[model samples]
Target: MPPMPARIIHTSIARDWREVYAFMADHEKMPLWASGLSAGLTREGEEWLAPGPLGNARVRFSPDNDYGVVDHLVTLADGQQVHNALRVVPNGDGAEVMFTLLRLPGMSDAQFAEDAAWVEKDLASLKSILESSKA
Candidate 1:
């Protein structure tokens, strides 16, 4: 299949990249910033279970690493799996957190735009929380 269109939604936080990575990599803390996971996640073996838009979802996050990669796979109740690529990179004294949102198959342009906006809002929340924490 052809590659789906993608948008990189990101925000800059006035915090160390490693610190930001540590906070985001912890899936349990995601609901504080990631609105999609506002209901929070519960560990179930190697995967996590969360109340998703389409019912329950199984989430498997990447293992801990030196790099700031916090990628994860979310399996919907309908058996649809979505791969999310997220990263926190150093930007001078601050960090830039980015989330790649792919326009999935059969997704309308308006739906894709809305998804991008949602991601943007989440990233903004992350930036606010992290940056404010330093004060």
Candidate 2:
């Protein structure tokens, strides 16, 4: 069988890179950008809990860093661990946010495309919020 593909979705945010990264890294602000985390998050020990299709799942975000990397590992209620890749990079005076979506083993092309579209919409939401706040 062919391997699952890794796809990236990105958007230009009209905010300072540092500001964008800081907001993106904060779990509390995720509901403002990431729909998958819309139900909100709470930290417990080393992990964070959020609502998803699998119910309340434990997520451990990578420790804060200076290089703009914002990766996270989500542990599903049923024991599946999914690694989600995300990043923010400087773009002139603003920033560009990118989200990497992985196509799981059993997912079909259609399903993968759907996920990609979802990421695009989520990024747009992020862009809208960050950019509008500056206006």
Candidate 3:
């Protein structure tokens, strides 16, 4: 199968870049926008576990300061596992978010679409929260 296409979403936040970056990097604030991510645990290294509404999964963060990339292993309640990579790039005033979901051998196209939608929604929510908090 062809490599999964990356979905890109852009939104402007009124807050400064530092505030926006801090909020985005804060794993504890994920549940505010990320669906199914009920809680997150951060380790000293780049590895972390984000508990979904169904089950827990592992995440790996890329070692980069200018750009942020996260690899997510999501386990569905039915025991299905999906791997996805989320990348964030800071725009001049806001940010640009990208999600590259790796499709399993037997995964359907609809599943990829659904995951992309979820990521876009999460980004939108993040933009809303950051912009609304502007002083």
* Model 2: per-residue Cα lDDT over 53-75, one tens digit each: 86898989989999899899988
The digit string of per-residue lDDT tens for model 3 on 6-88 reads 55545555656556666666666767877656465656465677666656666654443554554465545566666766656
Ranked by lDDT, the better of candidates 1 and 3 is 1
Candidate 1 residue 113 Cα shift, in angstroms, is: 0.5
Residue 95 lDDT (model 1): 93
Of the candidates shown, which would achieve the greatest lDDT relative to the real structure? 1
TM-score of each: 0.97, 0.92, 0.67
Superpose all Cα atoms of candidate 1 onto the true structure and report the RMSD in Å to 1 decimal.
1.2
Candidate 3 has its poorest 10 consecutive residues by lDDT at: 62-71
Which parts of model 2 are misplaced by more than 4 Å? 1-3
Clashing pairs in 2: none
- Which ranges in model 1 have alpha carbons more than 4 Å from their true place? none
| lDDT values for all models | 0.93, 0.88, 0.63
